[model samples]
Target: MTRSIYSFFICIIFLTAYSCKDNPKHTDDIAESPEQQLKQRYSKLVTYPLDSTAFPRSVNLKTNNLKKVPSKDWTSGFFAGNLWQIYELTGDTAYKNKAKKWTAFIEKEKFNDRTHDMGFKVFNSFGKGLKIEDDQEYKDNILMSAKTLITRYNDTVGSIRSWDFNKKRWKFPVIIDNMMNLELLFEATKISGDSIFHNIAVKHANTTLKNHFRPNNSTWHVLDYDPENGDIRMRVTHQGINDDSSWARGQAWGIYGFTMAYRYTKDQRYLDQAKATAAFFLDHPHLPEDGIPYWDFDAPNIPDEPRDVSAGAIVASALTELYAYTDNEYYLNYSKKVIHTIKSSDYILDKDIEYPFILDHSSGDWSKRSEMDEPIVYGDYYFLETLLRLKDLK
Candidate 1:
């Protein structure tokens, strides 16, 4: 009886393999294209009444609920930016109407000076809107947001203040992520022909280049400066595994920031910095073969840590632009690899998934145990941006 059962199981396995090989109508044949997947996801998202000042920040893992953020939140602009990108990508009127409506919710942030995230808030939404259709209102809001951002710049420290809440521990903290905010300043210069904006951006980049990096080109997440004498007080990490460990998203921000700087200034130093930083990220031993990175490179549990899809998406977008500048096949090919990896079943959400977001399984504030293993708004934004960049490359 045992021998008969073994023979029957063997025949079944062989037939299954043969059927799979012979059938051209497998799931791949019916799977939606990436563009189709995006449209379906956004169609679901637009069904929600997100017209208030509330924006989707990330999903709550325990409750499986989408977290709504206030308009003043640092992540306020990404959802609208995602909408704008979708409109540009598919030329869908539904997306354009939603983009305009959501972008209007963020216009008040142009006068919000409490945080140094104007670039993230204004540029991601209004800046993209202006780029798409050249709305005078969008352009005006962007310029106003740039003015609010420069208010955080300290001429003495030669860097923008990253946080005001941690005042006791950090006198004048400058996070590496601040480098991304400089895009607002650069754009302001072009819009107004004001060299002050350009000068501040250059000085900030120079100061960061001098202090924010180690000998190996890995960056610290934060650098605290003494406002009194323009002296470095401390270099630390707020979101990384430790004071010395590299945060995956921080590295991505560094890569994208320097690439953007190079685009604005045509500065060889920024380009070199971008390339070296990208190498540090890609050549790291801890990076997964699938192109997604752990929450932190130095996280204690290697291979078991949560992957930050936001970091992967940001890196893919930045690498595509870097490819345009350098014409390097490595950047282009690696970015394509990342894009494919993100589109795999592990990262991309199914149309029926309860989460109304596109990408899944991003690590947000892992140390705080917040938003762990969920979809973040910025992840969706960067994923769309990466797809658009890839389309342009094609």
Candidate 2:
């Protein structure tokens, strides 16, 4: 009886192996395409339960739970934009309906002027909605959002203030990320035919170009200005590994932001700045073979440091745009490589995951011990953007 039982177990194992070997239709035998994986993921995400009090933010890796952020959070608009992009890419009304619902929660933020994240909060949501259909309401809300964002712009500094907190440490802080908010201003001018918005956008981009970049073209993560005389008080960082180190995401932000500014202004300087920053990032010695970067380019630990998939996603999207202007195969190939790696199982979330985040292993701010190696909403947003851009290029 003991010999029979052992033989039975061995036979079952052999049969399973044989069956899988011959079965071409087996799920494990065929890899899902990136497009298929994302569309299916979006199909389920449209029905994912919401807290009714907040929008989906990131997963709490410690608890393996979805984290819902309030509307005031800087990342509040990203979820809605994700839904809108899903609709754009798939032409699925189910996603549009969910996008509309989620976007409504962010409309009120158009008037919330306390933070410089107005574009992140308002433009990402409402601006994405406008791209699908020219709704008067979305346009108006976006214009309002642009107007509110400019309130944070100090003419003395010729840049938008990034944070309202940590006043003691920074008199007027303008982060490299603020380069992204200029989009809302540029869009506002197009919709309203107002030169004010365009002028401000140009000024902000020019100011950032002058002061944010180091002699090597790597941008300082933050610049604090005197605020009175428009002179820079200090160049520092809040989220980078150190004051002088190149924060991966901040550099990615500079790439995306400057590339975008060039699109609007036809300013060769903006294009040059974008290309220089892209070179700094793509040529960095510490960048991984897979195209994803460590949390900081200058981190002490070379291969052992945490990866920021968000930075990779951001660069993939930005480089695709840069390729359009320059016809540079290097940029296109690198961007495609990033998308390839990001689409792999190492970055894409597992099929059985409870949350709606697409990619994982994005480090938000390593120094703060916040959202490290977790799924951030912005990572998914930029990943979707890369998908859209790549589709267009094809």
All candidates: CA RMSD in angstroms? 7.8, 8.2
Q: In model 1, where do residues sit more than 4 Å from their true spots?
A: 1-37
Residue-by-residue lDDT tens digits, candidate 1, 267-339: 9999999999999999999989888899899999988888998998899999989999999887877776776
Pairs of residues clashing in candidate 2: none
lDDT values, one for every candidate: 0.82, 0.83
Report the poorest 10 consecutive residues by lDDT, candidate 1.
1-10
TM-scores, one per candidate: 0.91, 0.90
Worst 10 residues of 2 by lDDT: 1-10
